[model samples]
Target: MTPDHPKSRRSFSDFLLHLHPRTIPEENLRLTLSWGLGGMAVMLVCLLFLTGILLLLTYQPSTGSAYASIVTLTREVRFGLWIRNIHHWSANLLVVIAMLHLLRIVLTGAFGQGRRLNWIIGLFLLFLLLSANFTGYLLPWDQLAYWAVTICTSMLGYIPVGGLWLQELFRGGAEIGPATLSNFCVLHVAFIPATLFVLLLWHFWLVRRAGGLVQVEHDNPDDVPVQRVPTVPNLIVREAAVGLVLVAFILILAIVWDAPLMEQANPGMSPNPAKAPWYFLGFQELLLHLHPVFASFLWPLLGVAALLWVPFWQDSALPTGVWFGSNSGRRLVIWTATVGALTTLAIILADNLLLQSNAAVAVDTLVTRGLLPTALLIALLVGFYFLLVKGLKYTRAEAVMAGIVLVLVALAVCTIIGVWFRGAEMHLVWL
Candidate 1:
């Protein structure tokens, strides 16, 4: 037998304390909080990976074989159906958790101070996560996936100069074909994951270095106290618990129902009441009410520009972590509301535009319309910006009023885009 060493007798607790240089407190709330979400994110990623690997064994990426392979996985392979369900749900869950995490940071004002870079990276991660889901959605080669991509890629047409070329790059052709499927598959499987993994590492590293936001800090420096606990165990525990609960729920769902597989995708057949994915449904609903050019292109572009320019709009008025003393809090709330409203309006426009027009019901002719609506949209954006950024006085009430107006404007724009796309009569199924 090997001789007993003095260090070995000290136990795991002794080793942990030595490494951390901080005591593991009897009650470490910080650790508990951090671990909860972190663990959930990890578990969800693992679940997605495992399911995706299993799916790859059965999935065929070719245009001809793609739908058939999915059908086979659902009908023939044992537990294959369950695995797919888990995969689908996990993708959605990942998006949801990431959004919640972003919200948590914002609501707590944790993104102020030293964590701004992390906030930007977190936002980019959210965008990439959404992109991953979108790519994966198209792989099934179903009606819903088909139309969703059609409308989504169609929006790329709004880009200046090289918009058409960029759209072509996405489609790999004029329509959905082998190239589109293969490219999206590669992105969903490899590109997205690689980017996410790198950014996530940077994100966590920032979190570890800066410390998980001053979760319960007082605005007044006199009232603020130094945090004592190192976040590790308790945080992990909470994250694990949330993840376990989610996994249990997902497993039960998988056991009860198989993944949904629609028709074999006959390109010629038109489903009269075709729909986009539920999330995009709000946008599709926009098409029923708004003018295609204005609603679809100009309005949406302005909305994105507005989001990117928010920090700049505030200028140099407030310093980092300075939430109070000025009207910043109210202004921030207004800003968030404006963005949310803009998103909602975009949806409404999609739903209601072309409801009364002769060409409205058709799904193939959206692009043929003239430049008037588009020009009007551009003009409206310029007018709105002038009013919101220049004309409106910088006050709490002004901010509140601006937010309300933004919501209405955005909803209208999205509704218009939806109507324009749906009315084209192309038999698109974005669901």
Candidate 2:
């Protein structure tokens, strides 16, 4: 017997239809606008989710068996290696695509004014993605995964108060062990994915609600708006095409690189230069130059807070929806960003050179680590604000774009240095 009749029952097809609008403006279909980064990222998410589910069938999260299970999955099970590699690569790629997607939003002024809440949601997603990645990194039960996670969790112990407790709460003990693995395994496979699904739904809905991408005429910024096309075939087909290319790229990497799985974790034998995961190497590298508090937490926290506050603090009413607003806006962003990059690099260089020899121990550490570097950053941003306001006469939205570019450049430089330039003992080795 069939179930009781329902009013307008929600079928699978109906749910698919409800996902996006039947039609979107033709202008919203511009590939050059958003670069399909968000769509590709979403596809990566789905790919990883499926592969991860398959892996879960045979993988054991227990400490004693975790390493053995992963080994069995990679070497014993049929096509298990391919599935694991794809899942691993897709997880890494998702973070990169998400960062690129965020950059697109910043450059295009997509998070301006009325979109403040979406910006916050995006930040939360970023945090969750990073958290998920961190938790997943430990699942392999290998040397790289073990040491990297140990270092990452230990960083939290440096927090002023209740920090150690928080660290232990996640660690499941005073140290990284079986309980810690169990906690992360649950968080990685369960909590993060569930939270991500909810946020993704909200993100997509907001995109549709916000009327899709902002229409911008390159030759004429002030020109009237363009028409939108249906999201079904036009937008959907294009996204699928881009997604196919992305999948091919990931598959090729999985074939060529096969996810690195070192010997099972040896807490006794620490790898030399035991680096954090590549995504976090930037923060670890900064620890070489700055105080732990600043490098590990405060500095990055400040950057995130600034991004969260930008939409709220900057002029919300200012005309947005265009990439860099006006032509003048583009020039302003370029010049300010260039200055900010150079300024940060110069400060870093000076601290390494001049401040290293300073006999005033307390003063040298403070200057090189925290106070002076921060003061310079503040001054640079202030200078940028004046230049945007007085020199270029920029609207608030335009200035915020420039500011974001500067921050992105600084962070990128640090990441590049950390990942490629640092040598044994975290020394700056020219690569």
Candidate 3:
């Protein structure tokens, strides 16, 4: 059919249909496939952008006016509360969806094959999304936003040599003032969004070029290639449905809970036990138990480097894109995850109980916060490395997956502690 046809003009769905293939295999759209996470992330991104634009109309980025503007917008502007709330919730959900999307890829071993480069791209996008959240959250300049940014940037300044310079770059000075707010506002609304859009399109193009989705359930390698369908009616409609549900879910959240806005920022007084945003709480939790250098910089950089190098190490016997790479890989994942979780829990529990019980293990002292935990973490990884190499006799790919699983579990445990179990002064406090 031509563009001028009456059918084409019926609704905006026609234009959207062009973006997807006409049909996909009926099995590909199964809820078990991808869990609709990638689609949900995209939908949330679009929702955030739409609502952000609306919120921007009334928001002023100046430190003096930012909080007041938010108050005005919520109170006086029509549906301003709803729009900002939608943007807020979508931003939160987008982070979660991105993480889950990556988790799915890792679990399915979909990051192997030619999908390796795309995996790196996805990692970059994750950080970009995180940066988006960090910059955007400070716009309100409330006590929560203010103190959170302050603690974070201060922690950054604790990095050894260039830390101060990096922190200064973000702060625009010694403090989070008008200049800092303006810079963050510009980056949040303009540069980051633009770059993310370009990267997202590039990512999709690569996904298509690399072969759409991994056929995880296929049993025979010699069978005829699966017939594909147009993505429009099959995949596109499903995405639309997911988008509607996501929007409705967020709408309900917005109605029941307003986005938090504490009193305007006070430069003279920092909140007791000021916290970082929920996402960074995990790192904050780790920071409290490890040396600043390890907590804030070296450890994170090493993890990234390790992940970046995974695809280069290979075992010909292991086929790529198969879950855990094989049955042996599954065993490795389970063992590593269990070890990691238990080790992580034990370290945190020990620290909370003994950091004060013995003078030798005093909190903030080198032995308690620096030497011990760092050594333990290193030992855990090294032990897992040798375990996979010797006991399991796993391939390099499987070893890598095991290591990834261990790290993910440990980080997740730390995040849980930071988000839920810590209270004033970073002391352990059960919910």
Question: How would you encode candidate 1's per-residue C-alpha lDDT over 1-431 as one tens digit per residue?
Answer: 23366556445445544333342333335443333555567678889888999999999998888888998898899988888999998887787677556444533445545666676787678778888888998898987677677777776765557878988898898777788899899999999989988998788667656654435445785775554554345434455567789799889987886666777665676455565554454445534333444445555556555444443343322333223214754565567566756656554445334433455354333443325444655576556546655676454323423443454445544543444544445232343
Q: Which ten residues in a row have the lowest lDDT in candidate 2?
A: 1-10
Residue 74 Cα positional deviation in candidate 2, in Å, after optimal superposition? 1.3
Better of 1 and 3 by TM-score: 3
Clashes of each: 61, 8, 9
Q: Order the candidates by TM-score, highest first.
A: 3, 2, 1
Root-mean-square deviation of Cα positions for candidate 2 versus the true structure, in angstroms: 4.1
Please write out the lDDT profile of model 3 over residues 83-117, one tens digit for every residue: 88888899988988998898778776677677878
Q: Residue 162, candidate 1: how far off, in angstroms?
A: 1.6
The TM-score between candidate 3 and the true structure equals 0.91
Every candidate's lDDT: 0.62, 0.81, 0.80
**What root-mean-square deviation over C-alphas does model 1 reach?**
6.7
Considering lDDT, which of the candidate structures 1 and 2 is the better prediction for this target?
Answer: 2
Measured with C-alpha atoms, the lDDT of residue 78 in candidate 2 is: 94
Looking at model 3, the pairs that clash are 21-230, 21-231, 21-232, 22-230, 22-231, 23-229, 23-230, 23-231, 24-229
Among all windows of 10 consecutive residues in model 3, the one with the lowest summed lDDT is 314-323
Q: Kindly list the per-residue Cα lDDT of model 2 for residues 1-431, writing each as its tens digit.
A: 23433434435325655777777778778788889998898999999889989999989998899999999998899989989999999999998999999988887777765577788998999899999999999998999999999999988987768889999999999989999999999999999999999998898888767777655535674575556566656877898899999999988888888888999999998887888888888787677677777777778888888887777774632354566676787787778668767876776676556545864544326565677777867897888877877886777677677777888877777777778876776656786
In angstroms, give how far residue 79 of model 1 lies from its true place: 0.9
